[model samples]
Target: MSDERTETVGRSGRLTMRDIARLANVSMPTVSRVLNDSPLVTVETRTRVLEVAQAHGYAVNRNAKKLRQARTGTVAVMLDFASHRHGAIGDPFIFELLAGVSEALSIRNQELLLSPPGLDDTRAFEDFHRARGADGFIILGQGTRDAMLRSLARRGIPMVVWGAVSKDAGYCAVGSDNLLGGRLAGEYFRMRGRRRWLFLGDIRHAELRLRYEGLCQEAAEDKEVTVEYLPIASMAFNATGQTVSAYLAGGAQPDALFAFSDTAAMAAIGAFRERGLIAPDDYSLVGYNNIPPAANFSPALTTIDQKTDVAGALLVEKLMQHIDGGRARSILLPTQMVVRET
Candidate 1:
């Protein structure tokens, strides 16, 4: 390829503050200040420098730029890859939080790099800060005592944990009032004359802990009601079927159920059907995070609307403001209940 054309194809391969300054007829420091959006440069000087640099097709290498100035103009987002890719991502609660982040980032011309989740290497945070200068991070899903996060915290990695992170100052969090969610579930069941209730899904997920807490709090007010918590970890369709059989055979059938999530609600509903029972007919039921499929279900579902789209947008907004000279802050969006057939 021709040198000129090749350089155009690889702007990241060639451009630097030095080159920009050289073309703009300014000192390297002057160009550097403008690149960092420093107000020290007068408007005339800043405009002239920028025009010259742009005319010459100068571009900033994020890595090199960050190394020089300690910022990549980037924010990292960690998501539950397993859930997001599986079409199970949106539940009202999770959706709203993510929307808030995404909207905030978009206005500031920033992006969310949804880091894949896994049980693999946990030292990724250390490597991230070592090479690239990331100003901060936004953790989206359920990751606990992560090595990367801990190392980053030990080194003072600025971050906002949506529902992750300990309540330590090292981590800032924006999470739903899970206790409220649980209470709402319990209230819904109690009002419907359900005294014996069942709960489904793993209690290990961080969010579930909050949901369960909320339900217990509300159910405690009612003396006659009892809430049973069940774990289905590592259990598949057939195994879950057998587990459900035991519940029926043992005569511990619940008058109502409040699942930790919509998926779990569906799973429970399926289990109920397997035993020739109908939800909200033979027994009342309520679910959380009225996801799209919740409405499409055979009897639909009664649940909470956590507003994920708004949350995702808000997350983006927060990232953008922080990138553009804003200080860190925590935000909480409200939740509402959505009543349907079930």
Candidate 2:
């Protein structure tokens, strides 16, 4: 470590591995090894090289490194924008899931590329993979694209979905036990002596279907209980609100209601209030996906907890397993009821 080497860096006004090597009195290869955190480098040499590089503010070009390694070192996170009336970006649950995945990727020193919506088809997935856009993908929702996802899996595409798990699904998935979540809500309503029940949310999607089925199953246990449902295509606030408002205007009276999502439940609540109806007193309501706003809602929502905190780690782990030529199995997390004002 001589002053001459420091002067050389000042003269060039740019830092490089070669400069770091010279300053550390080591070969360029040694500097590269140390910078890459290769275990082959001795502790003393690694420390000296790192100190020199840190002192000069030298940083490795990750893009060049990834290119040389022939791997993008990035994961593309895709969401089904069309499924939601306001797009997936408008959903708070989507943001929560993204934050989890982003944190998990950061821990592994990998980049997260948020893919735009409408990349739901297999060919689009293939093209993106072939173009070296990312090493793999993490889909946010299955949304009736199970067939397309199966095709991608058959073609050896590396992907993992965050949604309901299907028995015949070819790809890996990480999701909650939606059926149990619905049953819990149903049981709670029954205990509260709510006989007339109404369910909201489109069952065309596999996850929502399971929840509806579970609620129905629980309701069937009591002959006096009657369950009805309204098919809602979009989870957008305005769309759900309008749909619920119209249903209420039609004189649809139900003592209990269960929504597939907290957002939908909130929208329904707004609709009910517009018609001079309220929860608990008028109807015992339950919602799914205990999102952040659920607890702080005017009458704090009673919803299901889907364990989103560890979902990202599991999704990233499973996707990496697929990328590494390993077969990763789908995981179904346990769901629980979070009782609140609603």
Candidate 3:
């Protein structure tokens, strides 16, 4: 082939994979397979081809890449109302989770399509199964009464959820051990001689409800330790702060507080300050998710770490299994405590 036809340089003066293969003393198809990250290519051959490509500054052509890949290669990410209703979708925790998912997809040569907020769940799901837009769907958090999920499962849709796992839900899910997390928080409080424990966060959602149940169960054996549940009307900082303020104003004194998220826990701390109270002194507080900002709070937060990185990777791995016509089982990652001032 002519030099211009087979080895045109990109804006960065790029070398084509053909040129790379020639320089690395390998077949052109071998170079192509390595560039596409095909596991069929031997490790030593892939390393050599990649090293040569890197040394020569070879870059894949975008247009050619588009034509090479079959259909739209993407996974649809849908944030259900259970997570978006309180605006928790934009929280630091969610951002971390999404970053993990994005990284996992990048490594697998796929893209992520985030469904528009407030999207009709049925329509988005239909697009995944019928319209052939995304290879599969990943629901960030399942809303209460997931009837739509059941219907789609009956139709044999390939989807995964990042929330509570229940046989009744009838969907493959990947989530942390919320029951263990809540029990840990409650047990710690009881061990510290806390009498009144307050549970914060909405229990209507399956995950929060599981955490609530776990906390209540932990305190069940202790007659002296009383556990109370209060729904977070909204996840907004101000809303959570106001809710805590109202509870304090109503003469409810909690010796320990187990919040559903770091966002809620931090907001409650601010509310406590406004009410002339401090954590671990006046009361002990535990938060979930261990988001980045959890450690920066004034009293720092004691929280349950869900290991977002691992969670994200597992979610993608399970989704890929379903997409490839394999059965994807539910996964429950372990939780650990990050003890800070609170």
- List, in order, the clash count of every candidate structure: 34, 0, 0
* Cα TM-score per model: 0.71, 0.89, 0.79
Q: Per-residue CA lDDT of candidate 2, range 15-85, in tens? A: 88778878899999999899788999999999999999888878789878877876788999988776876
Give stretches of model 2 more than 4 Å off: 1-3, 6-23, 50-59, 86-88, 116-118
On lDDT, the leading prediction is 2
Predicted structure 1: lDDT: 0.66
Residue clash pairs of candidate 3: none
Q: Residue-wise lDDT of candidate 3 within 133-191, one digit each (tens)?
A: 67788878776646777777777778888888887777798898899998999888887
The lDDT, on a scale of 0 to 1, for candidate 2 is: 0.89
Report the number of the highest-TM-score candidate: 2
Tens digits of per-residue lDDT for model 1, 173-257: 5556666777888888878988988876566666677778778888889899898987764324344445666677677779888
Candidate 1 lDDT trough over 10 residues, lowest sum = 2-11
What lDDT score goes with residue 111 in model 3? Answer: 83
Model 3 regions more than 4 Å off = 1-71, 81-88
C-alpha local distance difference test of each model: 0.66, 0.89, 0.81
Alpha-carbon error at 78 in model 3, in Å?
Answer: 1.6
